[model samples]
Target: MAAPDPDPASAGDGPGPVALVIGSSAGYGLAATLVGLRTHRMRGLGIAFEAPETGRRTASAGWYRTARTAELAAGADFAFLRDDAFSDGVKEEAADLLAARFGKVDLLIYSIAAPRRTDPLTGEVHHSVIKPLGTDYRAKTLVFEDSAPRIGALHLPAADGAEREATVQVMGGADWQLWIDALQSRDLLADGFRTVALSYVGSDITAPVYRAGTIGAAKQHLEDTARALDARLGDAGHAHTVVAGAAVTQASTAIPSIALYTSILHRVTADRWQTPVDQAAALWSRLTGAAALGLDDQGRVRLDDWEMNPEVQAAVRTAWDRADTDSISTLADTDWFRDQVGRLYGWHVPGVDYETPAETTVPWPAPAGLGVTTHSS
Candidate 1:
């Protein structure tokens, strides 16, 4: 397909400000891409690892969502490289793609969530674990068992030996730093450019499994990387961490503990609930607004301000005390949780016909002829 004409109000005649979004399929990455194209008025280059449509098996939700983003983009340039963002040569190919379509990227959003990662240089594979750091973590986990919302206690063991290190390798901000390094090395980053890595730091109820878990260790590393990158920008760009709210992401259902937390979080948050897309818009707004990015005492972006409200947490804590097998349905917004998850797969989407079959295969634009990276380095 021919590329859409550049938006007239661009930084240059080359292309409108570009957004290079890693892990741009479902959840926060995809939502950020929407904000980049719509609010930031930029071209999009999304990187993801969705398997292509097979004979019977269809493409992943990331694939479908990217397609929909292109459709709704209307006269805006959008392309997706169905590739792994964690490979050895992935960054080079991304630079090449950006060079071909949009010159320097103004925004880089890293929102990848995966089970494992590989050291592109050594080819050593590292897997991430969901466990507490020091001791056993006992939390009231909720799930829809056999169509009914139920709560139960989950005892997550601590990560031992190299488990914490491996988890950090898999989920930490190392790759994010590498990405910025690559972009900066090739002069692919525009002046005043920005990059953000999404993370979650919930209340103490889920801290052991989340904020204080192996993943938490990784997030700390991410914040450290952000601090370094911010200094490294040298007036040309900015890098930071964004703590997002709990939402029904594509992977949330698999983690029973998170599912329960989000369910109760939804109830406590009530009508002020924020979706993945809403979070994206909020992040974008902060990025583009005149007031500088608000930083907490620790110097990190806090997009989860609404979620961390004392009133909300207080109510959630009260509900936490009453959250039992019999009270789950009443205490948590189970219906909303389910509906949000459904929307990920084209279900519960407004104006979409659930009873009919739709086209499942669509070609993604490849201006640089750069294809996807299917395997780890």
Candidate 2:
């Protein structure tokens, strides 16, 4: 099949700016892509797991597909690679796809959140588990907003010996490094480009599953890699990491501690009327703008700092420490959690029909990057 011609007047052509987004299906990555699409007028190359579904399922109907279709129809160019980023072969194929379509990428966004990784060095597969490290941990878990809460215990499976090290190596920065190295070696990375990866650091209550967990260890290595990539970019381009504000994503749902964290966050943010996508848009604006992201005294991007404010964390911790299913919080009770979940599937609009089938078959412009092919559910 012949490739579509590059739109000379595409939105990204003026600044020579185009973004390649890993894990662009939903959550924060989708949020970031939305920002780039609407605010910065940037074209993107994306990959998502939902590409295989033929039916317009809720999970597959989010902005990744919706926005790509919209952009292509608008004469903007994009490519959606439906493959895992962890494998070298898949990454190479994706790179070739990009090269064939757009030739070079000026920005890269890494937002992958997987539960396990197969370690090449030790020849072992490691599954990520979440649990509190402290003795006898208990918290209130919300199965549904306004539904009764339940007391829950988080038991993380412990790993020892080479497995632990292998877990860190496989789930950590090595794959990220591989992507960058391959793109650079093939000259697919445009000069003066930037790359961003997402990270999180929360309070003691959630630390066991987040900041201090095995996943946290992987994040530390990610931070280290960011610094290394920045140096590698030298004077022409740069790389950095963002500790993103807490937002409920499919990835977050798997973490045991996050249920409580998200519940409390909903309780706190209910009255404020700000969405995670809102926070993401604000951060992406700063990151891709002419100005540099203002760093903290520790030299880390301070986006998540606001989410971890002393008063805010205290409220969430106290709520988790003092509630059970009988006294659990609900969306009707909190308003915030309800909104977040509604936005999750793009069904919370006032006049939209949440029960009826979605209009996933709406026409979108077909781009050279993403071939026009229908997926099966």
Predicted structure with the largest TM-score when compared to the true one: 1
lDDT (CA) per prediction: 0.78, 0.64
TM-scores, one per candidate: 0.90, 0.80
Poorest stretch of ten by lDDT in candidate 1: 1-10
Tens-place lDDT digits, model 2, residues 28-80: 77776666665566665776655433454433554345555455336556555
lDDT agreement of model 1 with the native = 0.78
After best superposition, candidate 1 residue 98: deviation in angstroms? 1.4
Task: Evaluate residue 31 in candidate 2 and report its C-alpha lDDT on the 0 to 100 scale.
Answer: 71
Evaluated with lDDT, which candidate comes out highest? Answer: 1
Off by over 4 Å in 2: 1-16, 54-73, 118-125, 132-138, 144-146, 157-163, 271-274, 290-292, 330-339, 342-350, 354-377
Q: Which lDDT tens digits does candidate 1 get at residues 1-377?
A: 11223334422355456788898877788777776676566685788887767788887777777777777676767677777788857788888878876788888999988889988978999999888888988878766667677777688778896999998998999899999989888888888899999988888777887778888899999999999999988688888898988777775565548877778888887779877777776687688763457788877778787788999989888988888887788988887778778877778777777788878776654433343333321
